[model samples]
Target chain A: MSKDKLTIGTLLFPDYDLLDVNGTLRMLGALENVNILMISQSGDKIKSNCQVGNYIDYNFDNCPELDVLFVPGGIGTRKEVNNPILLEFIKSQIPKVKYVLVVCTGGGLVAKTGLLDGKRATSNKIAWEWVTSQGSNVCWIKKARWVVDGKFYTSAGVSAGMDMALGFISDVYGREVADNIALRTEYDWHDNPDWDPFSDKILEKK
Target chain B: MSKDKLTIGTLLFPDYDLLDVNGTLRMLGALENVNILMISQSGDKIKSNCQVGNYIDYNFDNCPELDVLFVPGGIGTRKEVNNPILLEFIKSQIPKVKYVLVVCTGGGLVAKTGLLDGKRATSNKIAWEWVTSQGSNVCWIKKARWVVDGKFYTSAGVSAGMDMALGFISDVYGREVADNIALRTEYDWHDNPDWDPFSDKILEKK
Candidate 1:
């Protein structure tokens, strides 16, 4: 990790959501002084929830120090939440990283670590109940595109990660930089953190 | 390639945009019984514009027959547009596929092949001039989130690819299926094809 540039380590597990990682990185990667690293358990090609295979850059043992830690959720989180190695790795990175961003069910994996116990967070509306159950003490906001509490940023399912990533940029870099990136990408960014429309619709189905 | 399934072969080159491919696939991949194969000049890890490396599933010569051909644009298109191997590959796939989906400067790559010579299309608004220059006879639309000309579907820019893809789904599958996929992904889908706002802003800057 360079002293001048921010290092972002994104965790990749089996069955990880493609958009949750790539969509968010699409915005964050535009930053001029950021080192993005894809980290998996074994540094192998991790299969996404969409069945796409992505080769990772680093693994648990050899990952360099990171300024930001990103975790993307998928069906994999259901099984990975119980994996001791992953839980321990999340716990290890919590205290060192300046920011922690969790997308979709990834909030469940991090919440299970007990670090966000008292912090306000959110997750995929589709998996709200399951994820909310993971952290009994965590303040889970149901109606949010994303929630930013202290050093933690958690977004709603899949595509909402992009918005959360932009919000993260707005806080760290400034509003102009984030807005410029959105314009460059031609992304219709929901600047408001509370602009969530799926909570009621998705929750009603259950 | 299974006869019963729709095989989608996405072309990858060095400096290809990550979200252009992944974001589009994030929507399309949700379709049941669709085969998604990543293709490149060589079956190797191709570096993205963001400096991310993605491993491809097939090389041009060995690629199986595809129902849909996808092309994503990045800085690589500037150099690749002149590359015969790539130009020939794009030209060859034009007549065989059921649909041709081009994202960003990918419109430039396909247009350079002369297949889109008389077709109505569009590309990244920021790179409007450069992309429009690729196909001299092509009818390029200046204002559109995406344009569907016959079998061809072209999107404006990076994140717009997701909207174009969902539009592609809505057209092919029923509207309900596409809407369900958008709901599942929790994506705020701009369902209208003419919902482009960046064309004026980006082109004016030039």
Candidate 2:
């Protein structure tokens, strides 16, 4: 076990995707010395897009400096992209965190942070047009399950967050650690970074 | 919107797998006229196997008869299979619900109800030996992502529950409804029922 602990904060807003935050939590929170903290703007219980309320561990103002900031996206991300408080908070944390992970339209929220400028990233394919429309400087990949641009990690959509988290575990913790977690979950992970079939599925609908 | 609302009850014990319940919720709860209710022995919030507390919507004593019963397996399942109170509760509901879904080691938990006798089922591959040991009369399949034996659906492991839920939605709802949900999440769902590769992975490890 690593004696050194890494405080991993997941920023939650009202109507956040339940699977988006919870799936990543499975891999990231399971690791030893990785403290998982659910954070929200006011420390109030955040309702899921599914309407279930999730308890928060900390309010934005009181949260400690994070080693990893995990951001998940949902219907709420559309409104929060324009929230100055959230944008400023994300901006302030970018320089402090060791890594920044954005899932689904979470990339949209992070893109609003002015952090994805000149970085390769991705977001929910179904909402691709709307999500990428917010980030002018971002070099968005159209077909990727996930993208790793230096310390920033962005995934395609809801379930793809799990794939990115495992990939992240492989990058930071070791492949063996992630493989064991995958085995434990029995998740046949789409290990190939470009194995994004949903991109075409979403596009084909048009 | 379907005016016929179905109360989907997820059976919660201490240390339940969060992904098993939440992942399926992302699919089933997203459907029209589906009510997601988390039920436990007590209405008090149940702690996930990962230690995060999930608020329960109802207690066993007052819960309305469910349209569907969702059972998820985890580390705590090892102790729950022997609980007479839980087995009796599961038995009582088996004859009332329209569908019974069990995920991962949840197969072990449900098998104790004696409801799975002679029914085709599957469970978490890693815990295959111990889980199968619990339900000798159940016809356990080794190479299946999910087994839909009439109204009962049992799946391989944690993540497999989501795939099973999508399939369940396709069966009860329509393909378009399930496809729309899959598209909204940008999920490349493993549509093939027999696409379980983890069966070999676990066996090879032995």
Which residue runs does candidate 1 get wrong by more than 4 Å?
Answer: A1-3, B1-3
Per-residue lDDT tens digits for candidate 1, residues B1-206, read 22367899999999888899899988988988898999999887878877675668999889999999999998899999989999999999989999999999999999989999888998999999899999989999999999999999999999999999999988888789889999989999999989888987878667
lDDT for residue A72 in candidate 2, whole number 0-100? 96
Error of 1 at B189 (Å): 0.4
**Model 2 interface CAPRI class:** medium
Model 1 chain A lowest lDDT segment of ten? A1-10
DockQ of each: 0.76, 0.66
Error of 2 at B115 (Å): 1.6
Over the stretch B148-198, how does candidate 2's per-residue lDDT look in tens digits? 998899998999999999988888787888888887887778878798889
Can you give the lDDT of residue B160 in candidate 2? Answer: 93
Cα TM-score per model: 0.97, 0.95
A81-179 in candidate 2: lDDT tens per residue? Answer: 889998888888888998999999888899987789999999998888889988989999999999999989999999999999999988887889889
Error of 2 at B87 (Å): 2.2
User: Which residue pairs of candidate 2 clash?
Assistant: none
* Predicted structure with the largest lDDT when compared to the true one: 1
Backbone atom clashes (below 3 Å) for every candidate: 0, 0
